[model samples]
Structures are given as C-alpha cells and as structure tokens.
Target: MRHLLVRLATVLAGVTVLAAPTAASVNLDVAGFGPAHHALAGHGVGYNINGYNWGGYAATGSGFTSVSATWTTPSATCNSRSDLYAPWVGLDGYGSSSVEQTGVATDCSSGRAVNEPWYEMYPAAPVYLSTSSYPVAAGNVIHASVTYAGGSSFTLTLTNQSRGWTYTTTKSLSGARRSSAEVIIESPPGRYPNFGTISFTGSTVNGSSLSSFNPVALDPSNGVYEAHTGALSGGNFSITYQHE
Candidate 1:
C-alpha cells in the first residue's frame, strides 16, 4: 500500500504559486494487495513503471536530466469506496527507489469528482498545491516538467494552460538514484481509482521529442500484477482501465 500526505484547498481567482515541500511515499508492493489488483506499470517515452500504469520514456543510463509532457485531464469513474488516480512527470523512479513528480489528481471520492494539483519527492509525502488562486479541474490541459538542478536539488513546474495558472517548486532530496525519467498515471493504495482514460502528448526527454527514440511497453512483472494496461503511439501515450 502507498501512503500519502495530502494538502489541499479550494480556490477561485488570482493565486500566487509558491515552492513548498510536502511529504508522501508509495509502497509499490503488489503482492501485499492480493491477486485481483489491476494496476499496470509501463516505461518508455521517457517513462518508468512500478505498481501503477505509466507512460513516458527513460534514458538508457544514469537517468535523464529533465522530462516534460502536456496532457489533458481524464474524467474518471469510481467505485463505492472512491478510487484515486494521478498523472505526473518526473525524474527517477525507474531503477531507483526515489522519484520526484508533480501533477494533478482526479479522484472519485464519496461519489463526487475531486481534483487537485500536487508535487512530491519520494522519501517524502505529496503536497497539494491548491490555493484560493490556482485551482485545477477535469479537462484542463496541463503541462508539467521536472528538472535536475544539480546535486540533490530539483525543480518541478506545472502549468494549467486551460486556466492560465501555474505552480513551481524547488527542493532538495537525499538518496535519489537519478536512474530514470517518467510520465505516469497511478492508483494510490486503497481501491484502484478507475482513472477513465488519460493521454500524454508532446513528451520529451533532455528537450527532444520521445518519437526520436525507441520506447518500450512496461511488462507486468514490474507491477507484480497481471495487467499491461497502456499503449504508446508516436509521441503520445494512453492509459486505460483493467478488465477482469
């Protein structure tokens, strides 16, 4: 099970975006959840996989210095317990235990849809960046990027292009392997969040389009689960729900 520390607020107008640190961690242990889990993990297009379904590309060695992508938020469905899903791009999380990622979470909680923007550096919890000024919602076109600023420091930026809002943050983290860069869609730990469908476009690594390289699909072994639930086309990646 993955544990999350969420910070959130509802906003309406002009908001000042600030760089802040929130702590959260995901335990990518699929065996603990039993055999029926539907999470899929994929890598390529500069992406990495774990217990969740992911789309993106990863460099061959020592990871990548930066990764970026533009995506449209997907409308999701929920079960009685309300599932959780997030779309993000970041450095690390491929061959290493550390991941620095930021993006939006669209959830079906209590039968209602909840959306929020957030950032996280692994070994810490995720911080929600929703203020009275910068709010995110479904169908928003978002551009997100993560860059290594040398050493243990990194910067993360998110732009809600549809609403003309943006958030940026920089932080220092220790023990990051810097092994891979990724764009991913993930289900936390409780119920599998039925993140309807998410598409990532214009994905790049080290400033080049993902189409310039040979990208691979994530295998089910990486997830310890049975579903290989994503696909890649040109420079885009799409994620779908798992079927029983």
Candidate 2:
C-alpha cells in the first residue's frame, strides 16, 4: 500500500480537530492520530498525560519492534451518528509522529452500531478491510499486532478469532520510528459511544509483557467522556466507561 499524505490536527477548547496538514495538499483525506500529545488535565485520575482521544496504557521506550494485544470487541450503544469507538494495538502513536496500527471500529450509522476491522499507517486514512471477506461483529475475539520486520518494513495483522478470519499486510514506511507501543480505545473524531467495559489481554511489546515498559495510564480527559482505567495485571487491564 502507498500512503504519503499527512493529517494536521489542532486542539480547540480541549476538543481535538484534525484538519488539513498543509494548505497545498490535494487529497480530501480523513484526519488521524499522529503523535501522543501530553498535557496534564488536573481533573483526570492518575493524570500521566492528556490523551485527548486516547484512553489506555502506553509503554514508551525505544526500538519497539512489536506490539500485540487481544480483546473482545465491545458492543457500543449508539444514540447519535457522531458516536465512534475503536480499540486498537499499535506502534509509535504514543510518542512518535507515525502510528502503524490495526483493530476494529464501532461506528454509529443512522443511530445503529456498525462494526468493521481496519489498519492504519497514520496520519494516513484507515484502510477498512474487504468488508465482504473480513466481516467483523460485536463480541468477536480480536487480536491485533504491529511488528517491525526489518528496515522500513512493518507487518500489521488483525485477526477475528471468533469468526476464524485473519487479515495481514506488510508495508514499508520510510520514516517510521517504532518508538512506543499502545493498547488504546480512541474516540477518534466524534462523540464516544457507550462501550461499557472493554479489557485487553496478552498485551505485549517485543514479545514481553506491556507492563514491563513502565506503562503510563492516560484518561482522555473529556469531562463525562472520561473513563476508568483498571490496574494493569500481568499485561492485562480493563477500561470501563464513565459518563457523568
């Protein structure tokens, strides 16, 4: 795959808005998560860094060659078209400008829940799978991984174990830094849907437990949109929705 465009983002009133990266850019590309921007929102619990749209633990280190995690896709209760939630495992988005990640996204379409699996080399658009072949539904056991094979080549895999389907791709991105690993639930660019409680198991970086990297907890700090991040246990943790 070829992705050469970048998405520019701005924080206005604590709401992150992704707009054109450059005025001269030609494509009407969708915005994406670039690097992890840290700001301490005092109201958040264990306020390690302001995650903006990220709510999970990120293990930051250098030369992170692999990051993987498994989770059961949560059922999102939707009330509006703007509701969106994505649980993903990725590399570099926690501290670097590039994120090579893949997982499932639950979107509210016409006020109903719609789920699909996708891979992204951000700040590029997410590549939704061949919807016909890569069908994903709620409660599916999804395992995702982004592995640095060598040089500029990386492999991203998203598997739907409950449905017995796997999608894997290898792409070369020249500037990828492979800095940090993450297992995150992101609101992306909309109102986060009610995903109840979702947990991640077997979280690992470079084939080791994610907690071994001194994982930092981020709360996303979005008022009622904030969530409760459970304590990490042997590379496993949970994020329960907290709407107040």
Candidate 3:
C-alpha cells in the first residue's frame, strides 16, 4: 500500500510517466510527490506532473516546519462501489518519503457517505478518530494541521468547528523529511466519489500564506476521474470534481 499510488510522475504528449524516486515511496498517500508541474502541452518545462490522485497545491522546498488549513467537509454523492474521498493538510511526500497528516474522510461503502476525522503518520496505517466522538458531517467547517515539533516528533491536529471538537496527537517518524507542505483533496488510494467542491481557506505553512510558497497545482488526473483546482488567493482555493 505504500508505493501503490506512485503513478504518473510526468506526462508527455504521448503519455509519459516519471516517479519521485526518494523517501516518498515509503510514505503512503493519495499521490506520490513526483517531480514538478509540467504539462504535456504548452508550458512544458520537462514532463507534465499534475493530475495524479490529488488536486490542490503543494509547496515544495525544505525545512518546512508546519502546515495547516481550514475547509468545509464536502457532501459526497456516493456510488454503490464504496468510493472514498478526503480533504486534508500535511507535510512532506512531495519530494520526500514520509507524510504526517490529518483531515476528514468520507467513505461511501454503505451506500451512503460516512464521514469521519482521521490522521496518519505515513508508513503506518491511518487512525480514524472514534466515530461516536469526533463526528464529521457534510458542510461542517474543519480545520487541520501538521507541525514538525523536532527530531522525528510531529503533532497532528483536526478540529470540527461546527461541532466544537478538536483532536490532537503527536507521533514520531524517524525518517520523515519535513521537506514540503500541502493542502489537497484526494481519493484514498482506490475508487472515488462525487464529492462536490471543497473550499479551503486560511491555508498556511509556517504561519504564512501557502500561495506565497509558490505551491505547485495538482489536477488529480488519474485517466479515469479528474478534478479541477481553482486559483489560489490569500492562501484560499477550491478543488472541484469534473468527471469520471
């Protein structure tokens, strides 16, 4: 499950792919960090590196200490196939191996969208918050953050503003790179659902606007389902579902 999402690092006019060959492999998430943003069409710097399994913005550099964002939990129009979706914030996994992240998960496994709050220190399976405790529902305002404390210890926090509840935890990941930060809407590594637009505001890295970091936009183009990313303004953006 770790390296399974490493698809399409680069795309050419004729369909080319490149993978981010680094610590990113050991960290399981929706999309592998890959290279940078290049498209198969015009503005082709090298290879197109958007539209993997995630859509939004990723700020790549090094020593990125923290990342946080607030978004509305999207109401998912579920399918019978049990598709899933999530909107979250994290650190690393852009060009590094590990991701320390937290957010809300919407699963359609039961013919209805079931929403829950969760967190993950990659290489480790995600831990969902107690459903009966940290309840999440569509349209609820959610704020999540991942901060690198120091020396392999990091903190993850998820809050449901509408519910007035917050869950915070700190864990250790010895190999984490702390190299990148991102805010994204992604499918959980399998099928997808018709999650409407996810509007993210107050997105930041190190207490500054995420857009100021020159974040690269991702399209969540998996050749099946594709999502669109709205332009970033004051660290605010939206990810919308297009088609499957």
| Every candidate's lDDT | 0.59, 0.74, 0.71
* Worst 10 contiguous positions by lDDT, candidate 2: 4-13
Candidate 3, which segments miss by more than 4 Å at Cα?
1-49
* Top lDDT prediction, candidate number: 2
- The clash count of every prediction, one per candidate, is 16, 0, 6
Global CA lDDT computed for model 1: 0.59
Model 1 Cα shift for residue 16 (angstroms): 38
Candidate 2 lDDT over residue span 1-244, tens digit each: 2231221122122344532233233233545544455544544544445576788889887888999999998887875665666889998876566788888877664468778788888767778776579988878899999999898888999999999998999987778877789998876553577888999999999999988888888766554435767788878999987751
Residue runs of model 2 more than 4 Å from their true location after superposition:
1-28, 42-49
Query: Clashes in model 3: which pairs?
Result: 10-18, 23-97, 24-96, 24-97, 38-48, 51-221
Between candidates 1 and 3, the TM-score winner: 3
lDDT of 2: 0.74
Per-residue lDDT for 170-218 in model 3, tens only? Answer: 9998988777899987663334578868899999999999989999877
Ranking by lDDT: 2, 3, 1
Winner on TM-score between 2 and 3 is 2
Candidate 1 backbone overlaps, count:
16
